[model samples]
Target chain A: MQLSDSLNQLIEALRCQPGIGPKSAQRIAFHLLERDRKGGTQLGSALTKAMTAIGHCQTCRTFCEQPQCDICLSTKRQDSGTLCVVESPTDVLAIEQTGQYLGLYFVLMGHLSPIDGIGPKEIGLDVLEQKLSQGGINEVILATNPSVEGETTAYYIAQLCHKNNVGASRIAHGIPVGGELDLVDGRTLMHAFSGRRVVTQE
Target chain B: MQLSDSLNQLIEALRCQPGIGPKSAQRIAFHLLERDRKGGTQLGSALTKAMTAIGHCQTCRTFCEQPQCDICLSTKRQDSGTLCVVESPTDVLAIEQTGQYLGLYFVLMGHLSPIDGIGPKEIGLDVLEQKLSQGGINEVILATNPSVEGETTAYYIAQLCHKNNVGASRIAHGIPVGGELDLVDGRTLMHAFSGRRVVTQE
Candidate 1:
């Protein structure tokens, strides 16, 4: 290739992003080089700063520049005494977008995949247990994904919550609100039937 | 979003890439933060170095860290006295990968789009004309894309080559080598018929 060494290095480095292959990496590199050098410079500084400064919040394990995240530090969220556990930081953002759940969050960062060597401690369950044993939180909501690993991780965390005398509950599993029953998968339809709520009483 | 400041900035900066949207940007940010901080750091440095260090080659207008590209400086290619004019650096890379072309390239960076205010000067045609006048090149191959703007740019460059007594020819346009004739578009099929070459004597 006639590409300069720095440009080639830039293309190679761009592939580090998820879902960016060789073609996409080359496109991005050229786009930045040709049209968006300022944007490229901005992204470079942003990546450098984030990679160096961002760290897991001590209280919840979600990414935060400080020891504790803004949500954990907020008096209202802390006093609410409800902690929602999730697999990643994005899930925390998804739940926060609803604005209905005004509780704090505990990001596991990953699920309990024993095959991949991810255990309870790896997901920060020990820190969660310590927080539960400290005795201020009243409820722990398991908002993990509905995959096998997520379910196993939730169940283990529930057991830990019970050990510390705190109530633990998994989020409901059912067909999506806007989805048709027939279009839903079999297991999801079953969950919808079993978890059905009574409407307007008798 | 509950994302920290640095993390949020990183996500925002990631959207500057060509095809990445908000969702992809968030996914990339979370992925780097959760699993590949090292890769993220490498990409950061690479971007910074490339954005600051890489500049256009004086001879070809393609990306290069120094004054001229390696291909432009190579004695064998310099003495070949044949120049290939292309729309972008990627096209040069594509042609080089074919292993048939040994001549050097002149990258226009983009085609002429009058609506976007791009003209001869913007695509660096003046430099190309000057190079043509310098008298080392014998043949100038116009390898721009088959789009209307690409055609216009190629025609303009061909005129410049003729003015300077250099032979200019456009690359062939037809259905791809392995493609079915039935699947080919009308204009391409028409071009194939008009540009057909003779076979061995019957």
Candidate 2:
């Protein structure tokens, strides 16, 4: 059927996401048309506002509206000489939901994937090393995902932390094989967090 | 986790759609950030644009950008005799996808569900009767869904059409039980279209 050019354009734009196929895109488009016209407007405004307002935290590289994220700004947090490293800002959110791990975060913003041409520098590993060298960090937890790429990235970071003589640990691999951190259940994620293992220097 | 107020607001607004949970909403929000920052803005803008630009088709009761929808405005469509009656505009799109029907459409926009307090006036049955009495149309294919509510609505409309001496027919029920037309495969929808039965005058 011939939808209006404007409606068609909107659906085409939404189809860029991973799971949203054409049919689902059309359903979403029609649904937006059916209800929440005002909501649709807000979504547009919010997207622009967020893109322009939110920036990566200088310390952790996680998304933040201010120069420092809430976790970084708060003195109430543990900050007990421990830091957890992760791939993306969303990962930080996943970890925070447990209400455990009060230590600081170091967001990599990406993982090491040689095949994809992503190197240590691409993921801000040098920045991480610089932060560790500054001292006061007794423990560094490798909380990257459990994928092959994540494992490789974790190992590289772990080796670097050991060279700097900082205590290094790797988050557990209890997560299912070939699973994304975002897809894991909350309780399972909690278990994985508590079962982290210390990395032996080689 | 402490999401910024704007990000949190965007997530809340997106969660209103069917099948979108909190995590999915966040994923979509993040993906929007990564790609099509502009398109995300457009989606919100379009939501408001469509909501404000469109209203129900005056003739069919289906959503339309103008007073008469594209389907109604098309001179190439077979508008001389037959009319296909449907429950919603989405249903109209479903039927149109088959490339089988060449007749005009009359959208009910709702069904006769007394428990939901929906009645004839609410669904625009009076307008349908008025169109039938105008005496140019010969057949009305009742393309309402096969659910209990859909069946009841079809029967009520069929009765009205028969009393007015207009030829009325109900679309087939070969559609699987508990299945919506939008979800059914196009081929099966084609089968249902071909297998339509004529409504007997009682």
Q: Pick the candidate with the highest lDDT.
A: 1
Question: Each prediction's interface RMSD?
Answer: 1.1, 2.4
Candidate 2 structure quality by residue, lDDT tens digits, B30-137? 877654567676666665566567677788777766788777777765456889998877888888998998889998877898888889998899898998888777
User: Could you give me the TM-score of model 1 versus the true structure?
Assistant: 0.96
lDDT for residue A126 in candidate 1, whole number 0-100: 88
A199: Cα error in model 2, Å? 19
- lDDT string, candidate 1, B1-202, tens digits: 4667888899999999999999999999999989999999999999999999999889998888899888988999999999999998889889999999999899999999999999999999889888899999999999999999999999999999999999999999998999999999999999999999989897
Count of clashes, each model: 0, 2
Against the hidden true structure, what lDDT does model 2 obtain? 0.80
Per prediction, the TM-score for chain B is 0.96, 0.82
Query: What tens digits encode model 1's per-residue C-alpha lDDT throughout A77-196?
Result: 999999999999889888889889998899999999989999889999889999999988999999999998989999999999999989999899998988888889999989889999
Instruction: Identify the CAPRI category of the predicted complex in candidate 2.
Output: acceptable
